[model samples]
Every structure is written in structure tokens, then in C-alpha cells.
Target: MTERESDVVIIGAGIAGLTAAYRIKKLFPKCSVLVLEAKDRVGGRTYTVDLTAANGTDKWDLGGQWVCRHQHHILWLLEELGIETYKQWLDGKKLMQIGGHRIKSHNSNLPPLPLLSLLDLGRALDKIENMVKQVPRDDPRLSKRANEWDNMTLEALRDQVSYTHATRDTFDIAIAMISGIRPREISALHFLHYSSMAGSFENLFEADNGGAQEWKVKGGLQQVSELLTDKIGKENVILSEPVKSIDQTEETSVLVTSETGQNYRCKYVINASPLHCSVAMDYKPSIPLTRQSLANRSPVGHLFKFIITYKKAFWRENGFSGEILGNGGAPVIPGCDSGPIQLIYDSVTGYGNPALVGFYANAWQWRLVDLEVRKASVLKHLTEFLGEEAANPIHFIDKDWTIEPFNGGCPVNTATTSALSFFFDGIRTPHDRVHWAGTESATQWNGYLSGAVQSGMRAADEVLTRLTPEIKLDGLLQELDNKFPEPSSSSVRGAVVMVAGSAMVAGLCMFMYWYLT
Candidate 1:
């Protein structure tokens, strides 16, 4: 092995890749591991920006912000890292504005406006709970049931409930907005999966401090990436190196060439890139047809996020909870505030001064992106809902995930149920020296931060189990070097270096064995 070589070369430095590197190092200390990131920075979609410059605002999350208490993986990691999270505030009255009318509502009661809207919301929740119970966690029966549900659209389900025209326009559209897909376009199974992950509509609605409140790092989510990097060492990580092609030759050895022409040889390669982004990489012995098909069919959800800083919490003064729900049309912004973004908090809750983070979802946002007119439109909507005084936000920042080169979309949605199932199975099956470890590839918490970590750990463990011989030999060499450190001339340094190099090679072999076996 040479200086340019590593036992395993991981592509992407997002949470998934970083977690994989950390797990590999912890499990195989003797092995050499390298993490290559195409971007200048880590944290793929998890970003926090300072909005103080714009409006004397505090911290703002641009991507992947909220975490539910039931989301065990992310919560556990935060606990382990000693990261603090504040509950989002959602007390007071919530506005249910639709068809140009503002309807006030509470968590325990129906909105004061329309009976149809109330029934739609109630029926939607009941159906969601029933659907969630229908799908047992990790049940092999899921695939079969998914197949059945895949044949039906969300619109069809709504029709079964016999919702009125206005109710369908408001409530049905709202579901689509929350899921980032039109109700008619998304499969019913996907909705069930989302509901199951969320627990229930009531649980989803209730935030601890405010509304199913969001937690942020005192610094930023990027701190998690930094912590992982510190443990892996700078030498083992490479940035701005995009992998162009991967060649798996005889004996399970992989030759990876970057876009810059630098080549790296490794026993195993973990591709933690997003599904859509992976399509750009060339594989010598092409990936399975199923995987390729999945990649091609990958769904890119609507992309929209913004932060508005006002003179004060103006909505609060008006007896509003600082929360607004709407469909995207004449009334409510469909899928508005379904998550923590639906609930506004004092910008100072995490790390800034004063600002509110707003989130949007679904076809309405997709149409906005398609038209390239989100910023101005968002401003107009905010102004209308919060009044003209609250219209001119001091600071406004938005992230268009659709335009991201590596992440062709924001979070994966339910529309691509079949594609996701295929891709998940295909990638996890392993092929030669190639391994897959990404948030989308996880068996649990498939689209969350914790799933990414779990996938990384699984990939690392697989490698550790495969290359036992090399690891054992490297361990012995390391012991010898440590015991004979006093050698001055023709010293153990040379031997130690050799052992270090061999350990890396062994790590590669282990990865190959794990991937192949």
C-alpha cells in the first residue's frame, strides 16, 4: 500500500459517510479509512445560518431542522453528544385560514369556521391512525401490503371519505402539501408509513414547549460533522474530491478515480451519496438494474424554506400563537406548519436574537420552484397573514434543495414508495467491494438523521466482520511497535509504519469480505 491508498474509501462526507468512518475507526482501529467529500463543507442537507445581519436575528436552520421525541436515533445521538434542544412554543390560538377566511382553532377543538373543514381534519387523523396500525414495523407483510396500496392514490382514499368539494380542496390539499406531493399522486401506503413514523396526528400536532418543537445545536448541526472529523483525523478525510468512476476488478479490489484524476485503491467502497446524485457516478461493472432503476425513479420533493424577522412577535400581540395553517391557493398555504416550522418560536430559542423560521411543502412549493418565484411570493403571503407591519421581514434566507447538485431534492417523500423499496433492498444487498450506507438505505428511520448514522454503523460492522485476519495481524504489528519504541537506529518507526500500512490494507480486505459475503 502507498500513501495514496486506503483500506476503504467512502464517498460523501454527509452524516451518513461521517458516521460510517467513525464506526469503522472505532471497530477497526488498525485499519486505514478515508472519507472523500465532493463539497467544500460537510453536513449535506443539515445547515444552520446566522440571520443576525439581516434582521438582528438569531440562528436559523436551512435544512433538516426538526426532531421528534419518538425519533429515537437522533434523540439518542443528541443525548450522547450532550447537545441541548429547546421546545418550540405553540401555545395560544392557531389560525386556520382558508378561502380568504381566517378560522381560529385550538388543539382540543374544531375551527370556528366550517363544519366540512373540521370533519376533514378529523377523518384525516382517524384514517392515518388506522393505516399506521395496519402496517406493523419491519413486517415482511409490509411489501405485500405496500404493493396493494401502491395501486391506489391518496385522492382515491379521500374520495372514499366522501369529503365535500370545499373540504377536499382544503383538507385533502393540506395532506398533499405536508407530504410534498399531490394527494392523488402519492400512494396510500406512503401516507401510512409517514403516519406510523409520526405516531399519530395528535402526537404530531403537540410540540413539547411550543408545537412538536424543534431542537437545534447550541452552535450548529455541523458540529456533529466536525466532531466526527476530529475523531477520524484530517489525514483520513479528503474534501472537494468527487468520485468520477469506480472499477471493481479481480479479487474484490476497487479502483476509484476522482474527477480531478487522482486515483484511490481500496478493498471496499461505501457509496453514501443521495440516490439522484449517484446517477452521475460511473460503475465499471454497472450497478444492479434494480438499483439503477430506483435511482432513475427517485422522487425529488418540493424545496422551500425561509426565515422572517419582524419588529416583534406581532402575531402574538393579536392573540395568535404565531402559527398559521393554509393551503397554497386562495386561502391556507397547504401543508403550512405541519411540523415545527408550522409553529413559530422566538428566534432567540436556539442561538440568535429574533426571527421566525418558516417551512413550506408540496406541489404548491414545487410549482413555486418551477416558476422560480418563491421569494417574492412568500413575502406577499407573509404580509397578508401577519399584516403589512409584519410584511417587511428584516432578514430573509431560503434554501432551494432542488438546485443542489449533490442533493437533487430535499427529503424523500411517499410518492416514490416502490422506487424506495427497490433501492433500499438493492443497495443493502451489497455487490463485490461496493457497499451502500446512506439515510435512504437504512432499514429503520429511513429518512431521518438517525437512520444515516445507523446505516454507517451497519456498513462499518460489516467490514469489521469480513477482514479478521488482516486486522489480527495488524494488531500484532502495532503491539510490537509500541513495545520497541526506544529503538534509535534502524528503529521500530519503519516497522511501525509498515504495520500501519498493512493495517489499512487489512481494513480494505475486511470491507471487501463484508461486502462480498
Candidate 2:
């Protein structure tokens, strides 16, 4: 029943939307902006909650929390916001569990697997890495084997490349942790494209040295959005206002109606929500079937994240790195029960709250269980991996993003078979006046915090061009470009790493052959 006007309107007050608003306001201080969020919060996937420990209450991030040096945009944003970051605790022995309950501890990066399994894993990873290098960063469909790779699922590719059960299961676990989807659900081309976005498959999996999980923000990752909202002014952001429809009947302005009958009229609109949420809205002229199909094909990843705060860092005390990677009970495919966990990492708070975090990926069966049952299973698994000390925790918190109304799932959306190749244009192409700005629309670090920031900047740039055709690229936008240039091609880096890895694998194979003889 109420109406308002603004120069620009942004849907979803997550990092992407807020970043767009921030960028616009910074560039043109006179332009009015409004950000509407369905949930009663600012940060979308980046959630930071407090957990009570013996010492005091400390905060823990249950959502996207990791950052690396190579992720220039997010690192630059952290520096701009005066936020500090600490390296992820990764010293000491690490544990790996495979083939049910069989656990092994190793101090080095290599998992404690047999020589043959290790060699098999090395060859399989190298082969996949080579395939990933061929996928273009801007569009996966342009890859040489896009049609062939897109038609097959990642599970198919895994089966074809890996010779050992251990190698296959390890690859599955990594995929689950990275994408939050079963291997059978995502396209091989999509997986390769994701790897290319991170610069390489190794960067996606490695925890240090230009890897995705190298560092953690000191306070919480959510502070990025919070600080952006602060800079954008709290009055400019409206929460609990889910957009119902967008009508661009007027040639010069967009009319966005909320579920509560509140209307916002703006010159341009930027949709920064997940693909699923954007599909829920009713468009005036109707979105193209291709774009709608893109949303239907790209399903949000199902992920159940849990964090446990203990009285002390017992694993570290015992000289364990608090990092655990396991495939649960047994390897699994779609249409079958799966083990409850994939990976765990040291989640100690910045203020020294002893804690650990983990994820239940590709295990939809666990989602049906109650919190108590889920908590018990996770604690039991932790006890087996860490020690009896993990059984008792000061506080335990878990988030099943599947059930969240606004966000159907957490992390990111995975392209179904052939979706990336057939519907690639629907992702970033502007529909009339509505532009896209989610992490999924990014090119460099898609599905990551850095990606969200980059997409927002891109969207802001697009709108600036449309609004003032004569506007020049000077000021903050130009400064950012000069200070943090886009990263170099990952193919070059991946080739170097792959060569060294292949050499090591060949040497190991020869050594094992000689030893057996």
C-alpha cells in the first residue's frame, strides 16, 4: 500500500547486494539506493553465531568462512574494513578415515593410503586437472569437450578416471565438501569450471599457500556485509520484505512489490539473491523459459553444517591438527543411504574458544533426523576421529540450510547435466533492466565470498553505464582495478603443479615397482 522511489533498488541484502549498494553510493554519493532482504538479516550465507564456552561467549561462523591470499577482492575488502585475519590452524598430525572406521594419522599433506591407491589418486587428479584447464573461465560451454563433459555427471568422470575404491571415495568426499552435492548430481563440465574459477583443483582443496581455506576473518565473515550495510546506512536497508513480483511495464522505471504490499519504484533493479529465490518471483513480461530452466536445472546444494565448542582444544593438545577428512561409513551414490559426514576442520574462535566444525554433505538421510539424533551422530563420529573428549561439548549448533525458507540451501548451486552448456547465457545476461549480482554470476571465484564481492562490483558497473552513459571509470572503481587486478590464468599455474605432481607420481610408481621386484 505504500510507495517509494530510489535511483537503484537491490533485492537480497547479502554480501553481493550490499556490495552493489556500497559501490554505487561510493561512486555517486547523490544517487539514492534501497536494499530489501527477505530474511531479517544482512549476510545471506555468511552467518556468525555465538557459542558459550567455559571462558566466555565466543563467535563462530557456520557459513562461508574461509579466505585465501589469492582471493584478492575479499582480502582487499577485509583490509578496507579494518578486519584482521588469522591463518587456519593446520599444524600437527591429520586424520583420514576410509572404508568405515579405519583411521590413519599422517603429518604430511598426503593421506595415509597404500602406495597403489596414492598413485591411482595422483593420476586421476592429474587427468581431471588437465580437463579443467581446457574449460574457459567466462563460460564452461565454450570448452572443447563441453557437450561431452556436460552430458556426463561428475560421478561418471570419477568412475572413469579413478582405478581404486579409495581414490574414488576420496574424490567424492572432496566434491561433497566443495559443492555440497552428490557426485551424481553435478555435470563434469560444471565441476571443471568450478575448479577453473578457483584457479585449479588443488587450490580448491588445499588449505594453505594460495588455497581457498587458507585464512579466517578475525571476528566473523558476516562482518563484511554488516560493515557494508553500515556504510550504506541502516535506513537504506529494509529487512523481512520478500519481493513478490517485479513489473517493468514502465520503460524508464521498475516497480518492485513486496509480499506485504510495499512497493519500490526505481530506475534500475539488481537481483543478488540465489537463483532459486529469483525464480520464485513473478515477472511482468515473464522471464524467458531458458532462464527459468536454468534455475530449475541448477539446484541448490544440500548441506548440513554443525559446530561444537569444547572446553579445550584437546586434539591440538594431543598434537593433532584438528583436521579430519573421511568418507563416512562407505562410498555411496545417489538413491542410497550415505554416511553423515565428509570433512572437519579446526574452528577455534578468534578469541581462543576451542571448537571444531564439520559438514554433512550428500547425506540427505541425515536431514530427516532431529537435532538430537544429528548431534549424537556427529559427536560419535568426532569421538572416533578425535578422542573421547569430543563427546562432551559446552555448546553444539547446527544449521540445515535445506529447510531455510529464503535460502533453500547453502554454499552454491550446482549445474545439472548439460545445464551449464545449454543455458549459460541466462546466468549473467541482463534481462531488460534487471541485472544479476550473486556469487554464482562471478567469473574468478564463483561460489565464494570473493566471488560475491566481484559480482556486486560488476553489477554496479553495469548499472552505472546504463544510468549515465557518459560516466568515466575514475574514482573508487578505477582505484580498485589498479590496486587489485584480476588474477592471472590458472591454467598456467595448474600446468606447473600438474607436471611436478606427475613427476612425483612416476617416481613413486617406479620405486614401488622396484621394491616389489
Candidate 3:
């Protein structure tokens, strides 16, 4: 194997890995950085698609495209990169499919549902909002109700609350949208952690002014990685170099081998890949059992993101914002055998191109139907939701994350049932000169691109201190978490009061959504 040496070597050129490399090269100009990636391109989950039908300028963000106003680190990075942001369109009414009936509503807070079901949904949201505060982002395992919540799935919670079919469908869609998995697949504790990481479920879903899907990059989200790569210098990053193994027994971790017969003898190795990918590499002296267990349990999300380009914003002309969601069919809930369309958003690009972006379905639904048949069914359903105009799109492209090479899925990796309590903490624990950085290891916005940036910055600090012992900057990374301090008892009570007061102002439909996700 061809051997080389560098001060620091980072594996995987995703946002996390690239960010770390960029920070190192920027902060310590003398230190050399070698970024080895499995894929030829950067921006792991944040990939932008080009659909110029035979030749017209049209692009779509098929991956992690939206950023929340609350994600300050990402916003800061955008500003530094000279990337501009634009707000999502919400000028018209939204469409919701309930019990096979499609209803359009102008309200942003509440979905159209019966009063009985709305009350039940309200109670569920309140419970989630209050309970999620108990889950600390740093270490959810230590929470008082960790065990009970871990053992039970969000599905069990749905049953426990005895929600109506409408409420159940809403819960199912929300969980699937967040985790990219069915509600039955994710544990209650895991769901609560997601809520806590985002401050609350309301911030997680809302898009009006300050929500997660609040803004879009002018060019595309992938531009962030492209700009970072440009700053780091093309020569520093080596693509198509999938790392095969890491030997860290020595003080310097003197050897790291790639699948293509390249060897790196570096002082420190920053493993910037997700735990799932990291554990795949052969490690000398073997990693801890907890690390292996966490890797085994951490599953990437299974989702298919599609962008259907239209000649114009047809739905907007019809007074529709192009937002579509539901539990199933409502009281008649649609099962896996029924259809695959889960959520659809009005994704009109910054260039004033008319398009609709949608999440087709989870892995389970994808398996139920063939691709061509699924496409046809989606168009038929879109026709039902919009009109005949939906059937004739300029071009439509679908990205199936489940089948993507070098990446089994999209969004970010998630902790499986019981894994968080037993083994998740060990995921970021370094082995000698080897360290970790990925969205999965982030305490804030764990599954988003912003989380990846945070983890990358944190890992850079870690390596900096290790490389220059005299620097002694131990708590630099902790500063990011300081802004998100734990909520005090009084604050929690005040929040509850505020939510109660909102319910008193608006109906239960609006109150529950304001209180929760």
C-alpha cells in the first residue's frame, strides 16, 4: 500500500467531515488535513438534483434542503459562505387528506379534524411537550423515565391514549415525517429526544416564520459543502477512497488503510462518518462492545424524496399551498397496501420554478408496489389532490435513499429500541488518537444538517486540544450547548401556562399544535 502522513486525517467527506477539515485548515494553517471520502462527492445527505428536461435550467434539493431559523450554527455558516436564504411559500391554503376526504384550510396551526378527535390530539400534544422536556439532549439514557419510554414504541402510546383514527393517522404521519420510519418502529423515548433536541415539536414542524422547514438556500443546500470544499482546497480531499481499516493501538494511530490500497499514517484520525459506517471498518484491537452494539442498532432512515416539476404553480392558482398529509384515510385509515404518498410540500424553487416536493413512503410501502406502478399511482393521487393539471408535470425525479450506494438512507442515523439507554453514549467515545464526528453524535438537531456542523466543530476542538496539549481548551465545544440551557421548573410551568392560555384564546385544535409538534 502507498503510505503517506498528515497531521490530521478525516474519513468521510460529508458535511461533518468536511466542516471539521475546513475548521482545522482555517484555524491551524500549518497543520495538514487529508479528507478521505467513500463517495466521490461531498454533502452526504444534502444532495441537489438537476432536472433540465432535455435543456432548461431547473434544480431540486432532493435531500436535507430546509433549515430552521433556530439552527444558528448553520445560519452562521451560511453567512460565512455567502449563501443567501429564502422563506418557504405559505400564501395560500393547505390541503389535508382525511379519511379519504381532501380538505383545504387557510390556518397554519391546526389540521382539519372533528372536535372529539381534535381534543384527543390536543391532549396527546400536551403530554408530548411536557414529557419531552425531561429528555436531556446530551444524555437521554439518564432520564428518570428512560426505561419505560424506551421499551414502548410511539405506536403503544397511540393505543394507550386511545386516539381516534384521525388522531392516529396524524401521529403516524408526523412520526414518519420526522424519523422517516413508522411510528411503530421508533420508541417513545427516541421520539421524545427528537422533540427535546428541537426545543419542542412546534419548532420541529412549523414553517410560517421560525420553523424547521422555514427557509431554503438560494442555489441549493449542497452549495454549503461545495463552498467548504473549495475553501479546504481540492487537493486536500481525496474522493473514492473508502477507508477499509484503522489501527489505533499506537499513540499516533500510525496506520489507516483505504479499499483502493492507499495507506495513511497520521498522528490523529477523526472518523467523521456515522457510527454505522465507522463500525464497518476493521479496527485493530477491536472497538468496545458498546460501540459495536450502538452501530448495529443505529439504522439510517428509509425514505424516497421526489420533486415533480410543473409548468407553473397550478395549485397556487387554485388557492392551494400544496401541503398534503393525513394519518391514513382518517376514520378509514389507509394501510401500506393502499398508497405510498405520505407528505407533499410546495417546493417552488428560488428561480420561480413551479414544483412540488414530496416524501413518497417508508421502506415498507416502497416494497409493496413496483416503481412504475407507484409513479402512476402518485400522479393519480396528485390529480385527486389538485386537479387534471397535476397529471402533466414537465419532469419528475425520485431519489430513493434506501437504495443509494455508500448511503443506505437519508436524513441521519437513528438509535434503535433500547440502544440509546445501553450503548448510545459510547458512540462518540474516542479510542486513543481516533475521534468521532457526525450528526448522530450531535446533541442539538441530531438528525439535521445543522447537527452535523455542530458535531464537526466540536470534533475539531477535540483534535486541536489533543494535537496542541499546551492550548488546553477543554470546554470550547460546550459553548454551543450553553445557549440551549435546560429549562427550569418555573420556565416549564410558564410554558404550560402559555400553552393553556393559547388554548383558551384559540380552539383546542390550534392550542394543541402550538403546544406540541
Top candidate (lDDT)? 2
Superior candidate under TM-score, 2 versus 3? 2
Worst window of 10 by summed lDDT in candidate 3: 326-335
What would the per-residue lDDT of candidate 3 be over residues 257-299, giving only the tens digit for each residue?
9999889988988898877888899988788888888878777
**How much lDDT does each candidate structure score?**
0.61, 0.85, 0.78
Q: Give the C-alpha lDDT of model 1.
A: 0.61
TM-score of each: 0.78, 0.92, 0.90
Off by over 4 Å in 1: 1-3, 53-57, 99-113, 139-144, 165-178, 198-214, 331-348, 360-376, 413-424, 469-517
Ranking by TM-score: 2, 3, 1
Query: How well does candidate 1 match the true structure in TM-score terms?
Result: 0.78
Task: Name the best candidate (by TM-score).
Answer: 2
Angstrom error at residue 135, model 1? 2.3
lDDT of model number 2: 0.85
Clash counts for all predictions: 17, 0, 5
